[model samples]
Target: MAPPVLVLCRLAPDTLAEFADRFRLLDFYASALPIHAFLAAVAADGDPPRVVLVFGGAPIRVGAELLDAVPSLRCIITISAGLNHIDLTECARRGVQVANAGGIYSADVADYAVGLLFDVLRHVSAGNRYVRRGLWTERGDFVPLGSRIGGKRVGIIGLGNIGSAVARRLEAFGCVVSYHSRRRKEDVPYAYFPSARELAASSDVLVVACALTAETRHIVDRGVLDALGERGVVVNVARGANVDEAELVRALADGRVAGAGLEVFENEPNMPPELMAMDNVVLTPHQAVFTPESMADMRRVVVANLEAFFAGEPLLTLVE
Candidate 1:
């Protein structure tokens, strides 16, 4: 008999078919009953699932309470790279091994971050609007000048897999890169700043690529934005909570900061209406890691982790 596994979020049909082949999947998402009632019924069954599969999204939050409902759960496999949605501490306390998508999406996400930065610096999106609206034909060929990307000082937060990839790409474009991480890395050639403010003060553009944790929540606050100055740009590929949304809006509105490129926001699927009207801001719908190639890689990583867990082998991407 196949081992029992609980699925909490909606997955692609192909991915679901693959899981069904290897495990006995108890899908909470497909149940007609409310999730709480379904969980209660499962708990009463007393043969709790040994593993749970989840995705990184707002709807499914795995905390102590959820963990308590599945006392037999020994492993959690998430298809997303960010672990902000999972309660790592509680999982640790309960000896639940956690696995993530690892660096499979690093290259794709890094490429998107650089793309956003270029769009902001060169007014690519705004230029598209100008051309489409016939502003160029109506008002002659004059358009607002954009800053050059070459020789710009770039400061990156987190310096992890994605951040390091971003640095390498920027370097190829003749951009100087520095970074701020929890601690200084001994292997990297780039300069390391002790704090985000110091890094922002010296950088022409600030790129946020850190993970979201209690220590990192709102890490890029008003002070950091101010340090970037009136002529500086901010690009965030990390979690939206990493920057204070209200402070960022105020900074852009008052012209305290030059511009922004955002792929994430404090609220998913919703953003401040003021940003919609700004030509200097470039926004994407959290698609930094949505490439088809990356999606395939993610599926492989997730399956690998689950296979490893069931085989009693070391997980491919264990969160430690």
Candidate 2:
């Protein structure tokens, strides 16, 4: 008999079929009840699932209570690069191993970050709007001037895989790159700042690519925004909570900061109304990691980790 696996998020029908071939899949998304109620029913059934597969945007939360309900649960596999939604400490304490997508989306996200930066600097989206609205026909080629990307000082937060990829791409465009991480990376030649504010002070553009943790929540607050000053631009591909959204809105409204390119928001699928009216701001619906290549890579990593766990092999991409 195949091992029992609980699935807690929406996935492609083909992906579900693939998993079903290798495991006895218990799909929570297909259940009529809420996730907690479903888990309660499963717990009452007295045969706890041994593995759980989670995907991004799942409402099901893995906390101590949930873990306790599934006494036989040993592993969790998440198909996302970020693990902010998971309780790592609780999982560790309970001897429940956790695995993530393992940098599969890094290149795609980095490419999107650079694309956002370019859009902000060149006013690409705004220009398209101007053309579509017939403002160009009335104004006769008198659009506002855009800043040149070359020779700009770029500061990156979290010099991890995505950050490093962004740095490399920016370097090809003749932009000088510096970074701020939890600690300095010895291998990289880029200048390192001790804090976000310090990095913002020296950079013409600030790119946030860090992971969200307790220490990193609101890392790009008002102070850092102010240090970037009125002429500075911010491009965030990281978690929305990493930047204080209220403060960011205030700064943008008051012209304390020049502009922004955001792919994520504090409240997802619901962005601030003020940002909608701003021509200087460029917004995307958290699609930085949504490329077909990245999705395939993510599926591979997630499946590999699950297969490793079930086969009694060392798990790949173990969260630690």
Candidate 3:
């Protein structure tokens, strides 16, 4: 009999059907019951799932409560590069293997990060809004002039795959790129600052591309924004909580920080009302990694990880 694999998020019908052919797929997204009760019922069944497939965007977290309910679970496969939603410590404690979508979306996310930065610095989105509102004829070229992208000092928050890719793209545009990470990367030629504050202090623009963790949460706060100063801009392609949203609002409102381009927010699908009125801010739904090409790559990586786990081979993208 095929091993049961519990699925926790919405997936395309074709993707689900592909998995269903090789394994018994337990559809958690379709379940009407609460997660705990749903898991309870699944556990009560004779054949419990030994694997759980999850993705980002869903509120479901794979932690102790969910882990405890599925005693048979030995593996977790997530179709996301960021593992913030998964409890790595708990998975380690239970001897459960966790595999993530490593480097699959790096190029796409980096491309989007650069796009966001350009939108902020060049007022691309704001100019579009101005034209769309028919203000150009009424105002007669009163739209604010945009800053040049070349020769700007850009500081990146993380130097991982995504961050590194951002740095490379920015470098090609004649932007001087520096970075702040947990540790200085020996392989990269970019200058490294030991702290975010110092990085912000020196940068013309700050691009946040770090992961979300206890330490990284609110890493960019009022102090960092103040350091970036009134002429500096911010572009966040990382998690929303990485920058203190309230502080950012205050900064933008008071003109302490110049502008922003944001993809994610502290509370997703709902953002602060103040941002809607700001012409300098460009907001996109969490779609930095949703290109069709990247989605196909993600599916391949996910399937490979699951195949490796079930076949008793080393995972292609183990968290550790």
Candidate 4:
């Protein structure tokens, strides 16, 4: 008989050993079949593994049939904090357990978010782009003007793990920090706003780090953008869904906001044409969690989820 199978859609090559060692110890998990092929394998095999350990870039339809086809699949674990890709409702209906890696690694992301803020505020990319294009000498002084980081009001959305981390970094620069979330956490020292609109209206810089949820999709619409005013800038390190893409393009194109820093887009891998044409925008390839340390830590959480499930123990980070 084949060893019991455990489905992991995709994992970094370096992360395989940790998972392999944990699974190798369990008789059923040791033989736990590995299926990296994705939905095709899920569809082809009628009987499913006892659990599915999802990672970055993992794609499963998670429709009614996804749970129906794998009756044996008792748990679904996603290694990332973002919930945009997973289907929570369907999983709940099927009584399948769910878990997500949350707060495992947020410091690096906070650093990157602040780096992008300073990168845009200081015109670091604009300066670099000019230098590389042979226009640095002519435009260096006036093209990308410098601004004082101190005494500026910084507004943050969704002050969770990553957001709190960002708040600390920004406060170190002597900026007055305010934020908006579903509710306030008594532990955080930052000022809290009742709504995002209020935060935007008063801020010099708006950093969006909210989760991608039904209520938060496109929370930063024209109203919020306009609230930030022409001198303000926006930085988004959260899901692309939180900001209105069309409105953002118009704002950047018309100089509504001073500038924008985008690390994630509404559509992954396909950035809008309007964004590419603008010079006031600094873009990143969804690499906020690309640091070697963050990746390893995230991988550990993923493997732990898998190992715990196979051992018939409690999951490390169950989302539902």
Candidate 5:
């Protein structure tokens, strides 16, 4: 019998096909039963799955409750760069190995971040709406001028793979880049601020590209937004919780911050209704890494990590 693997989230058909017959996949994601009940049923079957496959975007959490329900689980493979949904602490306590997509989606996410910034700075989406509504023809030269991307001081939060990529892309556009991370990177050429507020104070554009954790939750609060001033733009491609959505909404409303480009929200699929009415704000569903190339690359990385785990080799993207 092939090794049994528990699948906890929906996967793309191409990704599922990659598994083929190598493992007997227990389709927990397709089941209607609640997660706990599903795990109980799997446990009662006397063939507890040793490996669990998960996706990062889903709200499903692999924490103590889930871990306790499946004692036989030895490994978890997530097809996303962000591991905020998974409980690394509990997984470590149980000695369960966890692997993620690593930097596979970094370039794609960076591109999306820059695109969002450009849209906000240049009022691209708002202008498109104006043209489509025939307002431009009705009222000639009435549209407000937009800020230029060139020569903007762009400050990036968490200068990791995605942030670094954003910096590089923005540099090509003649934007000056600086950063604020947990620590200043010795190898990086950009100036580093010790805190987000300081970075915002010095920046014309602030980009949030950090992971979501207790320390980072609402990291971009009112102080940071106020420091960015009325002419500054904020772009967040990271987890929604990384920024205080309420504070952001208020900032935009009061003109404390000029505008924002958000791809994620504090609540999934639901955002503050006020943001929808703002012409200066640009919003998108969390799809920074949804490109065809990134999807294929994600599938490859996930399969390679699973293969390595089953082969008793070191995981290709171990989360440690």
Candidate 6:
């Protein structure tokens, strides 16, 4: 009998069907796995399957535990960009091949990032709120408004696929784009800054698109915020742990930075109380890659990953 493939994250019908047709798919699972508490069912079933595919947004904690549970597991496929949810060390130790979909959702996230930029900078959301509250009728009195994104300085941290996508989108809006990465990428046309602080200081909008690793955990700290000053706005589509939650709250609270558009938080589903109270900021529940197009694309790639594995071919989009 072929080795069983355990699928997690409850993929869409087509992706599920495609995977099913390609592999010896195991027949137990459900939707809505709480990411942080993903291990709530760590090893609930009988024997662990040989090939495990995690399509959900759960963290590496669950992945680590799965390695322990599924001693026979030889491969893991994560359907998202961030592998922080997958335990790399344990995978290496056990010789489990791991793969991820880093570039799959880049465009969607970049569009969302720029959307937040325009909304916050142009007061688009606030303007809608203005009319909803019947304030537009008494519009003779002027509300303080800001300038357009046109020609505004945009600073991007992490010049990866998403960052480059953001740069291209922002550039079309007539915004000047500069980026800072650990090692500068030579292919992109944007100007490069050596440090986050320098980029934050130089741009009107500083966006965090870098990965969340030891080198970048809370890289967007108080010093970086201080450098950004009161006129600059911040946008983070990357993992929330990239910024110090307390410092970000304080920054927006005291006008250290003008505003922020945050889609991810340090502790999701439990936002800081201060964030809810702020009108200048826009928050999303980790929905940067939640668009229909992106969702469809994500599903397609995930199925392909599983298909490739079952075919005894190299995995698509493997994580280094």
What lDDT score belongs to each candidate, Candidate 1 first? 0.90, 0.89, 0.91, 0.78, 0.90, 0.80
Model 6 lDDT tens row, 68-149? 6556678887777887777787788777888888598999999999999888887777778788888888775336685588
lDDT digits (tens) for residues 80-182 of candidate 1:
8899989999999999999988999899999999999999999999999998999998987736788899999999999999999999999999999999999
Q: What stretches of model 3 exceed 4 Å from their correct place? A: none
Would you list the rank order by lDDT, best first?
3, 1, 5, 2, 6, 4
For residues 104-136, could you state the per-residue lDDT of candidate 2 as single tens digits? 899999999999999999999999999999988
Q: What's each prediction's TM-score?
A: 0.96, 0.97, 0.97, 0.88, 0.97, 0.88
Residue range 24-129, candidate 5, lDDT tens digits = 7787767888877888988777678888888765535888877888888899888877888899988998899999889999999999999999999889999999
What ranges in model 1 sit over 4 Å off?
44-47
lDDT of 3 by residue, 166-278 (tens): 99999999999999999998999999999999999999999999999999999999999999999989999989999999999999999999999999999898999999999
The residue ranges of model 5 lying beyond 4 angstroms of the native Cα positions read: 57-59
| Backbone clash count, each prediction separately | 0, 0, 0, 4, 0, 2
> How well does candidate 5 score on lDDT at residue 154?
98
**Cα-based lDDT at residue 295, candidate 6:** 73
Q: Which residue pairs does candidate 2 place in steric collision?
A: none
Which candidate tops lDDT?
A: 3
Candidate 1 shows a clash count of 0
Q: Write the per-residue lDDT of candidate 4 for residues 184-226, one digit (tens) a residue.
A: 8898888898888899999999999988889999999999999
TM-score of 2: 0.97
Worst lDDT window (10 residues) for model 2? 41-50
Candidate scoring better on TM-score of 4 and 5:
5
In TM-score terms, candidate 5 sits at 0.97
| TM-score between candidate 4 and the true structure | 0.88
